[model samples]
Target: MSKVVLVTGGSSGIGKSICDHLSGQGFIVYGTSRNPDSLNTPELPYTLLKLDVVDEENAKQVVKSIVDREGKIDVLINNAGVGITGPVEETPNSEIQKAFNTNFFGPINLMKAAMPYMRDQRKGLIINITSIAGYMGLPYRGIYCATKGALALVSESMQLEAHEFGIDICNLAPGDFNTNIASGRYHAPILEDSAYSRNYEQVLYVVNKQMDDAEDPAQMGIVVEKIIRKKNRKMHYRVGAFMEKFSIRLKQILPDKVFNKLLLNHYKL
Candidate 1:
């Protein structure tokens, strides 16, 4: 039987790309958008369902709907997330909590809801789409980095536990990808009078430019398909430019202060 796959945040960006690819490969794919009615793109290769991962009950309902219809969810792609940016001090507590709720807890809710069904089948795959930014604390994006970083760590523990039930949990972190994520992201107002305004503004420009020139979002689809086919799947995977992927390695080998210097120089802070 063809695998039944669920991809969150499927209205656009990486999630859309993944669903397109999987559907092309013959998987029964159900992509989720917070407001599927607004998309009105019935011609899509796969079905689009309504899901807002931040709502636990909504997440459960979506999962149940898939299982009820497909009989099993072979793969669950936790891709729905929000991007947040600002000086850590200037970023409000409410915004910070909201980012965590979406980027961190949201994925957990889906994983929790899907695991029981997956456990019953004793054969399933869960891919949590984290970020390469999670590998370190980039200036001005402290909150975003923290949220993705937290999810990466949490996914590791879940992967270990899932092994017992014949389920595979993996974290696939991507670097900057050409997508419409910039428009949807939360931006703490860049207060001109704030002390960090000049630096924040500079870095914000660089970040957006990176997104503009980044690799095609469709490339992520290819990577996701590759991960799905791997016979010896890894607990974690990364897909990005040479430098973006290298940055993670640099952080691993370089001293804290030296790596910090590299980041400062790169960001021109």
Candidate 2:
């Protein structure tokens, strides 16, 4: 039987690309969308399931449905997440809570739900899609970075804990990718009235430019496929533009002040 795989936020962007690529590679891939029917695309190769990762009950049912039919879930990709943009001070508590629920807690719920089955099978893979920003806080995207960073740390702990169970976990942090993420990002409504308003346009411009020049999302799909096929997968993988991936290494060697300066310069802060 083909390996069974589950991917969240599979309606579009990197999630959809991964589903298509893995399905072509002969995996029994199932992709989740908040509203799968909205896609209405006839060409998709993988199965679509309705899921809202923020809803723990729904996540459990989805996994149960998969395991019921497939007998085993070989891989779980926690890719469903939302983006928020604004100064941390200006972002509403509700927005921050919402981000945490979807980006961090949602993955936690799925992991908890799948662990019993995976542990019983004594083997499974969980891939958490994090971000290069998770390594450092970005100016306008502080909340988004925090969410990803939290998930990355959780994934690290999970890997260590699940090792004995014959399970593997990977935190894949990609830099900017050409996706519709920008349009979907939640912007703080107070930006116009805040003191930072004067420079907000410049910040927004830089952010948009980065996305426009971002690497192809399909590249991530290729990288994920390779990782899936590997026998001993690494715990962490970074994929994206050269600088974005290199920045992680640079932070390791550069002095705190030097790295901070470079980061501020990169963002024109």
Candidate 3:
């Protein structure tokens, strides 16, 4: 039987590319989005479902439905997430709530729902798509980074526990990929007229500029496909050219204060 794989956030950007690649690789791929109707393309190689991972009940139901049809779940990719930028102090409670719900809680809920079937089968792969920001914090991205960092830590602990059930877990930390995430970036809500307003404007400027200058999404999609195909997958896979290398080496070669100062200066924070 073909291995059944479920990819959350599979409608666009990196998710769409991964879906396309996996379907081509002969997996019984199921891609999901909150609104499947928004995609105006012909039918894809894989099945597409309406999944809002943030909703715990919906997530559980979707996983059960997939298991009912497929008999076994082989791969679960927790790729659904949103980006929220701004200082922690200035960012609204609602925006922070949404960020944690989408980025952190969504994956946790899906993983909780998928584990039962995978444990029963005694074979599965769980890939959590995180960011380099998960490892290294950046100015104006405190909330987003915190969510990814939490994911990375959770996946780490999950790997140890899942292995007992014959399940393999990995975290994919991509530096920067060209994605609609930039175009779809949600501005942090400005709740009041205060000192935070000026800082918020600065953050908006930096984030918007970076979004305008991101890499192609297809490239990272290909990398994700490669990771899935590997027989001995590492605990973490960092994709992207220069950014990954620089992030790794900078931590080794530069002083902490020096590197942070450079980052602050570069972003004009």
lDDT of 1 by residue, 130-215 (tens): 99999999999999999999999998998888899999989999999888888889998899799999999999988987776798
Runs off by more than 4 Å, candidate 1: 40-42
For candidate 3, write residues 179-209 as lDDT tens digits.
8786555666665776677766776787677
Clashing pairs in 3: 178-215
- The C-alpha lDDT values of all candidates are 0.92, 0.90, 0.85
Please name the candidate that would achieve the greatest TM-score relative to the true structure. 1
TM-score (C-alpha) between model 1 and the true structure: 0.98
**Ten contiguous residues minimizing lDDT sum, candidate 1:** 34-43
Better by lDDT, candidate 2 or 1: 1
Give Cα distance to truth, residue 106, candidate 2, Å: 0.7
Per-residue CA lDDT of model 2 for 3-37, tens digit only, reads: 99999998889999899899989999999999887
Which pairs, if any, clash in model 1?
A: none
